[model samples]
Target: MVKKMMQRILPRAFLGKPSLLRRSATASQSTLAQTVQENEPVLPKMPPFDYTPPPYTGPSAEEILSKRQQFLSPAVFHFFKNPLNLVDGKMQYLFDENGKRYLDAFGGIATVCCGHCHPKVVDAIVNQTKRLQHSTILYLNPAIADFAEALASKFPGDLKVVFFTNSGTEANELALLMARLYTGCQDVISIRNGYHGNAAGTMGATAQSSYKFNVVQLLMPSIHLTFISSFACVSKTGVHHAQNPDQYRGIFGSDGSKYARDVDDIITYGTSGRVAAFIGEAIQGVGGIMELAPGYLPSVYNTIRKAGGVCIADEVQSGFARTGSHFWGFEAHGVVPDIVTMAKGIGNGIPLGAVVTTPEIAKVLAHRSYFNTFGGNPVCTAAGHAVLQVIEQESLQQNAFTVGSYLKQRLTSLKDKYEIIGDVRGRGLMLGVELVTDRQLKTPAKVETLHLVDQIKDFLVDVMDYTLSKM
Candidate 1:
């Protein structure tokens, strides 16, 4: 068995920096804003502490390689074939065992929303652990109840019921179960290139083949795949518009001619077997953070609902104000889903997931005996509460809109400058820069993209070491 090493611990900062908006605003404006702001005087501004207990930097890369390889655990996924011996992280930065910090552009696949190890989140976790940590699901926990209420209030309509889980996959899994039971249908529809999760039930809902191709032996039954159209919108004369107004155009009816008819044809062909549910990510996460075209989700949801199928929005990556303009990505499309699954940024860095649905849907899923040992335990729920509070108090959602827009603007400009950049898309901080060999052909520059990624990694690792040199 591979042995686990004692990973370096990074102490939580007790205080946070003053909100930048406060610093920038005039005294009068700041006073007025504070009065109206829901939670003024957010987290206390903390000074940066000496993260290093002591300094001892002697190993070079060659030495570290030999040492690390000797202690390497086979259990790790080895992302990008490089084992990132991460030691600590703060705000949008991660540090390796060697005390090198990285910009953390990926945000652990868009999980770290309020930055890493936020003071409020850390304080909640630490304080809650002192009072109560793990509480059985059989008992009602105040923290989880508060968290559920806060989360429910964020969404539209009656998405009040919540089922807590350990990860996005679990959330999606629960969502699948809920949808099936609610609709009383066996067949599930997933948009092509849409990723749900890796669980057996969710894997069935996932349409991406790359992640599920080898798992054929364990794949679930009654899974149906359909394309969300990627075709560009054109005028009657066939002159295409560079930007399509509708994001979900391709999935339900992307054929330029007889789009609805094409959808109807598929629905009719599949009708012999009733579709229990249709699940899709509000915004495709791994499938390039691709936003749905206008009228796409609404049309698809309507179609699925008309077919007596419940619509599920897998908001694992697109929920909780990450998309800038709206609180949820589905809201952007004006489509309301029967079920919504979420994780990642919900509890900041804490491991937490939730499946929110209408009472009508929840009542149906209640048939199966469901229990989680630690889902929505006091501490995790407290952390989630803290995260939501931070999001509101600091106006992080608005920040996501402003800063994310700025970042996107910069990235788009970069795309214009760099011939290798094919497409730059995403809302707020959840952006993607698709690198391509030829802009005209839109050929993905895989090699160049990898090289650029490496360059960025190196720069972050070497140049950003000072902040966490002793971690």
Candidate 2:
């Protein structure tokens, strides 16, 4: 319904501006009409009239909020609040139904890579719809093959086989299945505060209280959850003051230096040399953007691999050039995983996800009956390809790095000025600001954090409202 409205409105918008177009004459016609002979390719002229947007006529914020309360869903109960009736989105902005825009710093939890509805992604989707949309995986789809090739080529070794899913959670679930199938073991190790997904199987892999509490039961009973490290490698969770040590701390210090060592010991001696997989996000996302120590990931992967286990990098939140310095977050740490699960920004806002793995693991998972209905649909793959292309062409990943650094610097300054910021850390655009009540005893200021978030949203609404009124 919304798509139809956009098509009608956009074409009318394009045609209405004759002056915006430039006409070029054909070679033969140009000889006859010198005035039109500008040595340019022949094209239709644009109509003249300033492109004025149709004014927003949706429900006001208050009215919409009131109405949302009446239409409840189990999904909404799971998230932060009622999802916004977002009317339009463009680079770095999400316009609410009332046309108020937000800066979109969080990028919808860092899913939007280039930006919301990037022009290239929009054009790709529009063009793809006119061609083909879906084809069963049972039959061959050229677009899917092309996407798989390009995606695999980006990686180093034989981590090449690709499987598409509708979301990151699904991707991780598939990757987990692959791990178990290959290792023939049930126990898996995930870092503390790390989040994989909300689905039945993936939920068991995630080690968050919030997600775990509401879950009816352990959907994947064999899965084991373990804490790798706190938000900042602290002794306990929450806001606590700790000197940001410039040096690498071994896993056997006054701090939980032995945290990773202990985990390794448990996986080795405790589990008696049997472990299925070690799954981790390149950077913890819902776990508050905790970065892995410089050598932490590689060390853990080596430990797991030596135990005949697979190491899976859950790149759902951290892939697709969101991590500025390198396209993949794991790249920054100089470690490669046996399998990589991805989503969020893969389609630049289109619903898509994937698992890229070594041929060995891929073959094992293939033997198991695994299938995704909308996985690697032609249209979605086209959008995905366009997004990847745009990120490179527009140097958006570089933008994420440079602009993200600036944003982080600004946040760091804010942290110094305000006592509430406990720690500010992240790479490229995948950044987080840990809030605390007291610097010394780092207590998470949950209420204060929510208040600040609300304040930021309110400010954007006010500023955008005033700007629109002037126009």
Candidate 3:
């Protein structure tokens, strides 16, 4: 059980960290350990914590799975073959039902900004809930107002107006709606393989086929919503998918201008001359943590604006200091977007999202009786404000920069030792290691990587079993 518990904690290996090769454990996680023979590098020792969660008193994982299979949506899924029942969390670790600790490098899908159940965030939520839980936007609430000002302060240029939502899907949905209305254009463009959200507008904007359903697009309402009923089944908006500026496998080989030309062609050939918006992430987190080819954003932004389209930066995955070098991923590209949509890390695991844009663009919503019913819940806003304060107070942005650089440097060195490592890219903490069956051909070794990683994880189980017995 102890050995299995340790395998549950395998964290940095997936990110290609060299912590496996004998080093001090970071606060977050331990280095990978295998049954090393003589002359092999030793597995780093885990640091001691003066903490352990109380015994769990709940249904077992199998029982929960049985209930879920019986009652829950079939679309929902779990990670490993047997789901891990995580019950408690600290800054960089999670506790399973049996109180086994696992280093949480995943950060709850990059949502836990200050770590799980961060004290400050918890305090803020509790205190705010004690005071006031929910109030419609028609009423005044200091939490929402204060948080809006603080979040708006993080932007540049005329992106002062803020609108809050419950998730990234809502944020992106609102942003796209604003773009179409403000620009009076029907065509939208998004980068291929980028994921924005799952709502009607955003699902159409989301370019990945795997995440997209055929009928959802057709059922989505048209851009001219006021004229049409909310349930009007207008064909999906004309969303042109631009070629992904993938530096590693792209035909242009890191030449972003070449990819930018594709968007120009898309505008000329795919739609009317004018477009509603051009949306993309600086770092494609869902698309293998690939950074857009150099100079891509500036060139694309210029072309989109020339076509009278607004440029939107979808910072859902790469925002809030996840990308170490900049506070917002788009900033690293040196472009200030006309609209920016963000979530995942804004409230340190709270269900909070926001869209920031110029006052002119934001005013489009005024044309309609637009509002999120549960968007600016006081408890959520208070928690979000506390998250912003914790990020600054802890200097987590700088920590991400410094630590991410170090990890990147170490990960880069692994390419020399392993022939399968095809490419190592991304800035700061948002990094990816692509495996290839044939390095020269760059054939994706998805199965091979998964099989090999599973072996490593299983080997870790053995190592933990050995170590725990000794202890």
Candidate 4:
């Protein structure tokens, strides 16, 4: 049913074409080269309206880079060979120090859902900041309470209780604890290539080796007293990873049921049969915008519940109408998770996140004193409330759906044209185009992918220029 609905919404041509990848390698290479050369640089045209940025009086990018190296952790990295020293943003466009506007395609790593520095959101933050800034959860603040009510209204089912945190990591950490406390089990299941957080508990749930560090050993032994880290690695012991049921490149094509069977097998063999929770991103964000196969979640959710576990939807990157089709990504799956963890767009780039669950599950937190110092800060909540309003008033969700679908269709055309463009997948604005050398083997064309990304950057810059010239 879900597949049929998707077919109605998206072009039928966008569906799986398994044999396309099996085309002759020589013809593929020739077509790829011809397509790459023929594709001209196209820039996003600027809107035909009057707008100008305030003068930038800050230090130069070079100076900032020097200061960053000296003051910030080396772990902090920047994209591009020459990193963008972005100084200003308005809606969907970002401006560098010289006021050169560029379309923000990634949307601040998919955090700025309603656009950067949205007036309504900024006004709310400014007004709230002027009224009251700092107050802990101990005090009764209307901002937090109001925002909580507003956020809870967005979800279906009994996911009414809201717990605020400073980041997605904190939200996931809290959710993990709630699941364990409710189920009285320590084992948790997450999908390979899924990322939850960087904190000790969430770090364990995260399956990607790229994000995991040696620091897990230092934090796990002391912080997570209930779980042991000696199960080979922090992620391996208490947490189990099911194969990411990738549609384009998986053992089971688009049959989600086939991949979900692995989760059942993992529970029977990998764990002690009973578990606390099954946590996953509705659409894997940093893991290359991979969407779980259709019917995967419904099957897995039931499987986890039968194993005495709760289902957690990590919406840090996929929530808040970003997917276009649904207000929440999990809604597209036709299953409601026991717990929903959100960040990124929830605060519109502000450091805010939350875990929404049922009252019965929330009672576990009440069993012991739990607090987050700056979780529901008044200003942040006000901004969050404003973000919700902006999304509704501006009809941004509809915009995401329309624009994202059009973009995906165009990307699909590119995939059909160029063999290097192996796959283009995702929903709404949260989309990805995977590049591969040999489509048959599904080999990652790393160097070519980087080049294509550079070309995209150049094209966006050109579009910005074109828009400015017309203005």
Candidate 5:
């Protein structure tokens, strides 16, 4: 309703799932394929899909850009110098204003688990919206209950209770609050180079400086207001970012136990050896798809539990079968998290997120009434349920495993061919290609990467190698 209302208020603003698009590339795109391996590697052919999106007749990209600059926040940005005015989506393909088609590989940052505007998901959303849209949690709604049960059933151990939110930020914030309440401690730990959200606690817990802003001084009313109105978006006050167990770039190398020791040292020396939670993404999506080193999560989870902390798995980008080999990303790490927060893929492309935890730990919320107006709205929940069904019915997880493995295998070969490709990491479709000028030094090839990006942009398809710091 809000997005629909916005459409009327600001014509040609945006509609449906947000699009990350760029203009079609020039013939120079051939450079990537030509820049292949020593064995003369051939790029994989994209699987053919039968459907075609309806013709697009929308405002031109220039018009949309003019309106956006005049009306939207200056901070809002998109890829490529000339951004794409995408108008329609069908399954894994997107259409620009000119009706030019492109295959979607990013999967809307891993949100389109069942694909964009999937028939099942759309049918569920439309059917549910036709009956009821919003009734808050005060009233009994089968959509919320049924979907919650189905989602919880997918988790291991006692993570059977679910709390809904409109975005990953809210889910993570709620998880932080629950952890603090459960452990009765203020100190929280997160992995370095991981992104949680942009809200207060989540932003603080997020380790990457790129995702944070200054003016977090809560007491500085004027600066804080100027920064984010009434919101405090910075300050790692009680948050401790543990050393990232990055195999390719971390100081500890691939010895995951050595990196886990850093968390133990933090607990022993920092705070009072008590922590509220330890939050980590099994595969660091925002951190250039860097996965936690093998044996890292198990050891860190044990140490955090010993410190009286709850282990929180932030699965915003890697959950809902995106990881291929596992339903949830943490499952790949061989540990059960006390609290699991997810979004992105939960409702396919809809704005939905959830925090699932054990029933015992969930009771802490009973101490105070907590409510979200649009957290589990019937339409979103219904779509979320449909997404789950589609994942099972279509067996997207197995498909991810099969396809992602092939893609990764090809990319690894490229690493051998090109010295610029310093690392190829990540699981399933959530993959990354890091570029370097020198293999031994692992020097980031920022300029070359940007040039390559400018060359292909989002017109890229069946990609295997290329990218610098992604900086």
Candidate 6:
């Protein structure tokens, strides 16, 4: 009875052939151990943290992709041929279905500053939602007032007044309107590769052909008053695209003063002498993380101010301590803008944006009745408040400085080794690596870039498989 029970409990192979069973088990264990040991060195050591993502039991990537195709906009594109069905996120990491973890290097297109679902931010959102979810800006809400005050403290000069919006686009639109109203001018100047937004008002300011649509031109009549009415319409609220001061591939090689000369020439030749605003991203986020040439903003700001234009810094991607060295990207450039538009990281993925300017400049909106129903909603403002607190408490700005400098050094080393790496630029966490076919010509190596992305995906997959096998 004892022997029968032992045989039943043991492997079938062990019943008749103990040697075979032992060999099979030993071989399998050895193979797995060897694989784990070989690949273990490649795995990035997790930072000292207690948080772990919950298990994902959702639909597969294929199902999600199919549903997305059926229900979502056709314009909505995805990265990776095998799209990542991300189900969860934490600080600097994202988890896909099957619990495969990935380092979120892109940070949701430079939006997730504090990380995905930060505990404090989530708690604040939940608390606010439980108390009061929605309220118009017209009504007195402490959340808005509190967040506005906190946000204002981060800025320099007289940029104290705040106007809440749902996105960077709206913030920029408001900034443009303020610039137009304050200076009584129409024409605006934007850098060639700079992206402001895609809304009707901002689309004109955005120079990229890919982002612009035919409807953009059609909407201009209704959007810009100068376009419809004949009031010094020689400039016509038209957006003049200035030559981007691309140090890597520009006419002038890192000579920011030379680039600023182009702005002066643009004002002289392109627009009416006077302009509304000169708006630019300190680091062009959507324009491949391009940093402005040194001394470019100061010179341009001087020129634009002389031309009756306010210097508007679009801090949508480079704000909220993402730049590492300073609280604002403009600070790194050593120039203070008259208007600052911010979003993305401000609310830590919550839909919130703000335009900050002087009390004097912000008064332009008060001349006419203006209101936003969802702007500065209790939940969003609460989340924004928590984000600011988290940044300070966690010392994320210093982390960005330390980690970003280390990352930049490593990337610079990679650039030294690889000829395809044309340029590695950007400040702090907001960095970009551009690939080129020729070092001299600086032709974009599009195919090579795609190949590199694929290689990374494969490597990540292998690492994930190894981890799962161990588990």
* Candidate that would win on lDDT: 4
What TM-score would you give candidate 3 relative to the actual structure?
Answer: 0.86
Q: Is 2 or 3 the stronger prediction by TM-score?
A: 3
* Ten-residue stretch with the least lDDT total in model 2: 232-241
Report the C-alpha lDDT of model 3 over 1-471, residue by residue, as the tens digit: 332332333333333533232322242233233312222424545456667788899999999999999999999888765568889887776788887666665687778879888889999999999989997988999999999999999999999999999999999988888887787776788999898888777888888888888764613344455675332222245687999999999889899999999999988877667787899989887788989988889999999998888999999889998887899999998999999998889988889999999999988999889978989889999998998998899999988888778767766776654456789999888888887756779989777566555545434433443443343
Question: How close is every model to the real structure, measured as TM-score?
Answer: 0.75, 0.77, 0.86, 0.88, 0.84, 0.86
Model 6 C-alpha lDDT per residue in residues 123-193, reported as the tens digit of each score: 99999999999968878889989999999999888999988999999999999989988887778899998
Between 3 and 5, whose TM-score is larger? 3
In order, the Cα lDDT scores of the candidates are 0.65, 0.67, 0.78, 0.81, 0.78, 0.79
CA RMSD of each candidate after superposition: 14.1, 16.3, 7.1, 6.6, 10.7, 11.5
Stretches of candidate 1 off by over 4 Å are 1-76, 79-83, 213-263, 461-471
Using TM-score as the yardstick, the better of models 1 and 5 is 5
Clashes of each: 12, 16, 0, 3, 0, 0
Candidate order by TM-score, decreasing, is 4, 3, 6, 5, 2, 1
Give the higher-lDDT candidate: 1 or 2: 2
Enumerate residue pairs that collide in model 6: none
Clashing residue pairs in candidate 5 (N, C-alpha, C atoms within 3 angstroms): none
lDDT of 4 by residue, 27-59 (tens): 554553443334323324555535678999999
In angstroms, how far off is 161's CA in candidate 5?
0.4
Better of 2 and 3 by lDDT: 3
Between 1 and 6, whose lDDT is larger?
A: 6
Model 3 residue 230 lDDT?
Answer: 35
Q: How many backbone clashes does candidate 3 have?
A: 0
Q: Is candidate 1 or candidate 6 better by TM-score?
A: 6
Query: What does candidate 1's lDDT look like per residue over 1-471, in tens digits?
Result: 000000000001101212211222243544534433433222222234445423335565457667666787754344443556666777766767676556677887888888888988999999989988786878877888898899888878888898899899999888777665565555566766777777776666566667674544223232222321222111111101112222333433343223323334445664433456767776788988777655666776776677777878888899878988888888887878888989999888678999998888888756778788878888888998898898899888898898788767656664432345567788977887776655556677776566556544554443333322322
